[model samples]
Target: MSAHYVGQIAPNYVHSTMQANSDDDSFTFTVGKLDAGMAILIGDKASLIEFPSLLLPSGVSSGSVVNIRVMRNDQQERRQKDEFDQLQEDILHTFGQQPPKAPALRLRNVTQTSVTLEWDRLSLATATLLSLDIYRNGERLAPIPNPLHNTSTKLSGLDLNAEYTFHLVLKTTAGTLTSPLIKTRTHTISDTSGISVCFGHVAEPELLEASKQALTNMKAKWSDRIQIDTTHYVCTDPRNPGAQEGSQGAGYAKAMQLSIPAVLPHWIFACHDQKKMVGISPFYLDQDPPNASSIKRSVEEVLGKQAPASSATEADTSGSPPPPVEKEPSSATTTQDAPLKSTPFAADDVPPSNKESVGVEEVSSSAPPPPIITTSAPSEDGDAEPQSTPAPPQVVITSSESSDRIAAAAEGESTTEDAVEQTQTTEGAEEDADGEMDEVSLGGPNGDDEQEEERRSY
Candidate 1:
């Protein structure tokens, strides 16, 4: 059964509203009408409302019709409770977790053989970390241990000729951040040849041209035939002989002179023989020293007179000189048997065959003989000074092993001087029947006859 009452109506309760006095309570009304003086009771915790007319109690009324509607306070409270629970769930889902930040990046010292990598320490307390990856030339290398904790690592076995790019990546719980690429290149070693030349003061252009020509000729003659693969030619100006200019003489002057350093006196020529530096020489010209004529005369006196010219012609026409003659050793009992015993030969004695071959022809006939010179004793009136002991002729035998040793020295090598000394130990064996001993020949390695032929042909 429904119970109703007629009275003045109240305003609708503010939609979904509650009494301000209640901390956790709300109220609603559904009756058809309400009296102006009608009263409602909420929970014991709910406070009374002062403006009952402003609040909605329920049913409609006209002209102060009285009505009664009961208030249901728990609906508003339950709605509020559901909303609070939903808000708590959202807050828990949104603020409960966060992703990890990437590690701090760093670069390490780099070199031709290898490169190093490093990184800042990571927060192990907050996030999980995996391996760190490295890249070179856009290619990924092996992943190393936790780079953040490790701090540094080395990457070796790199190519010296190539350029490389490096990148480091940190693998973390969230994601990775790769460092910007770093670049470096390795250095290379090359083959180089050096040339130095000095000449008297002359025109800059001419000097440069001469130097170029000389270097070009040397390269043409030696490059393919020897180990010299690259050449650097240097020239200097005439006005400032001490300054060095470029090959074309267009560059600035140098502080020091362009002369070959005295330690390296002359140009050294070399060729590779059997994997060893064998042929070597210094290109230099021999200048005739002053008083060379007197020296020549003295040498002739010590060596004795030359044989007649006809004997030389006869020997040549008969073909090569006869093979070496064997001398038989003489037998003697002992020094006790005879003091100053007579030997088969004497210090100055000459065999008949040797004497006949002893005229100036035998010694000088092979090539144009040196000029015959006469010496007169000094006069009392100081007309002439005693001919100085005819100074010995400076026989420049270009072929002595000494020259080979010198050549070896120029090339920064050691010589077999002991072998040369052993070969030359027997002094008397040097002389031949014609009174000339085996002489060091300056004529190059091919022999004197060949050198003469080359000279004539050229």
Candidate 2:
């Protein structure tokens, strides 16, 4: 009933009769018409059957008598299936059993701007290798040359203290396989363990030995050859005698060509002492070492002198003598009018009980009394220098409000200089009445005793 045949039909298997049910298995027919690919046959009962024209007997024309037979070919089916099973077995033994394996990757070393990566030997599993590629952060970086022989790669030009992801892709006849992702972080500038030092023209043997010892203490590596892994070139003066020997002073020229950091032995020592990597610019071989005293002087020049002491005894007992007297304010200004005014006061006018408050101590020397120095308030500009004016001692009794303003400035309560100037102006207006009383109180009745005490102190 089915027109399509799946198994081979051989001539040897054809028969004219069957032992059982011959009428159904075999039949006689006449070819009615032949088309391009189909043949029409009319059976004894006039039943039409569509068959392939190519399968019909050769040279058979239209209206020809032919015998048609349909039977199941179990032997041919079994034979073909056995052959197919053998073919599949051969393929499995040759390539399918063990195919290409994924590449295994790991990080070997990490520096500030570079990293070294290594991997296991590639497992092709008898499959032909097409190519091997490396990927960084999901992008193809480069193809590995001679992939079967090479297993390690050094990547430079990376960012310092940055995180990166890396993987390996292997392409082969079996399939394309990829390795697991490896996350790595480059070394920071302060990590001294990443330092790779190479000894160059070091004149002193002790210096070279000490440098190697220091590198060992810091867990840093060093090599005699200047390779791509070498990070620094340690040496003395390259211009000294025998420095240019041994193929340009044991890799000094190569270091210069590669622009490696050429530092003196002290760099290693300093790193060992601090337990961290220091800057190479200050320890360059051609540059001189910095002087500690010179650095201190430069810092002092920038910040200026510190504030003077608050107590009078400390200032008087200081080792340095008091500053020489400069031009003084005129004496014509009266203390009764301006209590805080710049005016000269005779030694006899100050009361004996309040002489200590005036910052004048009785001394056994004959030297002239030290002039009082009243420094003017700083200008409104924060960076403006304070103006110092030499004025003779005068009675100054500041009110509570004025004292509060001075305390605020000393304690840095108001940051702006304008606030300090405004406060000083307000304090001046409030001191008018208090100034008159302060002067009268200080001008005591014992003028001769005050003069005698002042003369004895000077």
Candidate 3:
């Protein structure tokens, strides 16, 4: 059967009927004769009915056509609800599958021994995150507990000379999420002795430059002078305790002593004079006393068993000395002192007729001795008293220099002690002076006394 068309339904609803006495003003309808699944409509809109009946108001027009169609209300409602659920599920899945993003990690205020690492927090809402694991190189270090969400963590006990790679991994309920790796090289911490030498002294730019050069030379020539562990030498100059101008050297020594426990176990002060180079053994309260035997053994191991006073004094100042040979103490000197006698190595034990015989030449033989005069200053008691003043700085012959002459003197077959005596005689002569004998009287016989006097006058 062909369906009849009807005009569009109006949104306005009217429930009242016309005021005619006759029944033609109202219309009545029924679905009683329609098929079980046929749709019925009052106007354009239709609703499906299954052997159902509906009534329409009475109207006078008998030719009016109402449209009828099927509508699946239950099926449409179910489809819409399903689509909404799928959309919510997709959002959650994306969040779970996506990788955890790590903000740029930074290491701030890094020093030789320590550094601070920081990063942005992960924002995964579903998972509960626990501690963060720290890594160096490829090894996993101890995890940082309860890491601050927005702050940094300080990592200590690091080797300054070594390179380190650091990164963070977060432990989550679902799994672990690793951040991007950050690579950085640690600053080298110089050996402890280097720091001790520089302690308390103001390291100006020039002084620092000099110190760096000196350190390089020291490392190259005397590697054993520096300790590897428990030592940290930074560029920064931290304040020294109880430091004063006159006591600066002492303060530096104290600082060095304090640092020894933490940085150096075996240490000695190498003191050099015109005659020899001697090792002043380090004294530690907790350790065994450093006796001459131990000192001699250490020196032999570090330097060599050349004559302690002779070879060192005759050595060339410009070049490094040869490796020292170990030797046993002489029987005559065995009972000298507890510290000195206990040494297994002695000066005589060293071979006198070695490859290059060091000369014991007098280093100051070319210089002439000056006359010494005492001047008295009036005292508070109106009596004349000798006023003491420091003699001018002199050129002290180093052991290295003595070693150079030792070989030459041996070649000439001259007595090394005779040359050494000559040098001492000249040095003594140069020390004497009259009144305040300016720079001229202090110079050696071969020195430019006239030029020195002119410079002093200016």
Candidate 4:
């Protein structure tokens, strides 16, 4: 009967437990973990009466023993259920639990040390509401003012190029509800001393980090949000000025617009290599940065140097002009190889069989690539300051195994320096770590011309 009574009155509730103590009709016991149990026990028909003589705490009078108690006829939770629910809701709202929706924060501006956050004020959350908690990475942050009616706040003292998580929370007797996590990262600058950079949302994270480190070393600043002083914008695509004004991206684009030159990664590297602020004129990369050499020329232009002109007769900027051309390692095919320019050789100087061979003629077959250049002596201190010692002319080739000079033409001859019929003492004879002679060899295409053979060290 009691179970059936409970079924109709409180289907999803537990029975409350109570102890009948004879001490002044008082009892002490705990309620079970069920929401409607106590409420069900407080039914309208609940009553108290004297217990049977056989039961615990039995007595003649109702006050002498504890029993199921009934509410006084004048007592009631409230005049109406709606009033009770309204009262509960009012208490929850009074404690900042107006039933808030999640806060969706949008990134405003980010700097190396701080970030600005913008969000809408939620309907249930009001100016007089209880504390609106701000949290970063689950750790609560203070100081945003209670009843946080403001729609935006700025977070400071952050790491550059680092990730951060944030959310909003409202706590009250009703329960705890929190906004979804909003994750973001700060920006790193490119050239601290030169441009104040503002990286856009579309920028690469790794590139931003690298640019920050590079820029810091360069003494530049990178910011997450655009500031009035930002000089440049680093991104793959920057919008035009005055486009979408007041929008999240428009302000940043305005900072990037004209007067400020949009630079490329090429310019970054070029500036680094040149150790100065390079121009964006040709360094703009619609694609991958141009090859390093091209960037080098661009860098030089910014450095105020006139690009060198090409000459039909190519000259080696390095001092001693390159020796005459020699046949490619392979002779079966003709190649467009041009050798060093030289004066016409005398008819008597050429072998009789090949009389037409003069000036810079390619060496015939059997010629190996010219020997590596080993040493170059500075010219006499004449009128000319050896304009940047051009690469030293090819030196003589000698065999490490013995003192014999090895060239395609110097097949058999006493090793000697150029202009000397007799050998000069091979001074400073030394051995290398491998126990081999520290021999130096300088060979060119004029394989047989001993005149071209200078000093030989082995």
Candidate with best TM-score: 2
Q: Residue 74 error for model 1, in Å?
A: 38
- Residue 233 accuracy (lDDT) in model 3: 24
Candidate 2 lDDT tens digits, 1-458 = 21223244524322322222355555566788998799997765466767788877777779887765556798878898999999999878766687777988987777888887889998887789999999998999999998989998878899989999999999888889999999988888778788888777777665566667667766789887776567888877654324544434536777788888788777776676556767788888667745322333222222333222323355567745445333333223323333332223334223222333223323212244444323233444644332332222222332322454333323322223332233233334434433533432223357547633532332
CA shift at 367, candidate 4, in angstroms?
A: 36
TM-score of 1: 0.22
Model 2 C-alpha lDDT versus the unseen true structure: 0.61
lDDT, each prediction: 0.38, 0.61, 0.40, 0.45
TM-score of each: 0.22, 0.44, 0.27, 0.28
- How much does candidate 2 score in TM-score? 0.44
How many pairs of residues collide in each model? 22, 0, 36, 19
Off by over 4 Å in 3: 1-99, 102-104, 148-150, 189-458
Q: In terms of lDDT, which candidate is stronger, 1 or 2?
A: 2
Q: Rank the candidates by lDDT, best first.
A: 2, 4, 3, 1
RMSD of each: 28.4, 22.2, 25.5, 21.8
Worst 10 residues of 3 by lDDT: 269-278
Find the number of clashing residue pairs for candidate 2: 0
lDDT of 4 by residue, 121-213 (tens): 754544324557788988999635645467777777788678999887766434566777788776654422535676654344444455555
Question: How well is each residue in 140-227 modelled by candidate 3, as lDDT tens digits?
Answer: 8877765645456767677765678888777777677777787776554333222223223333444333333433433422221222
**In model 4, which runs have C-alpha deviations exceeding 4 angstroms?**
1-98, 125-128, 191-457
Query: Model 4 residue 10 lDDT?
Result: 18
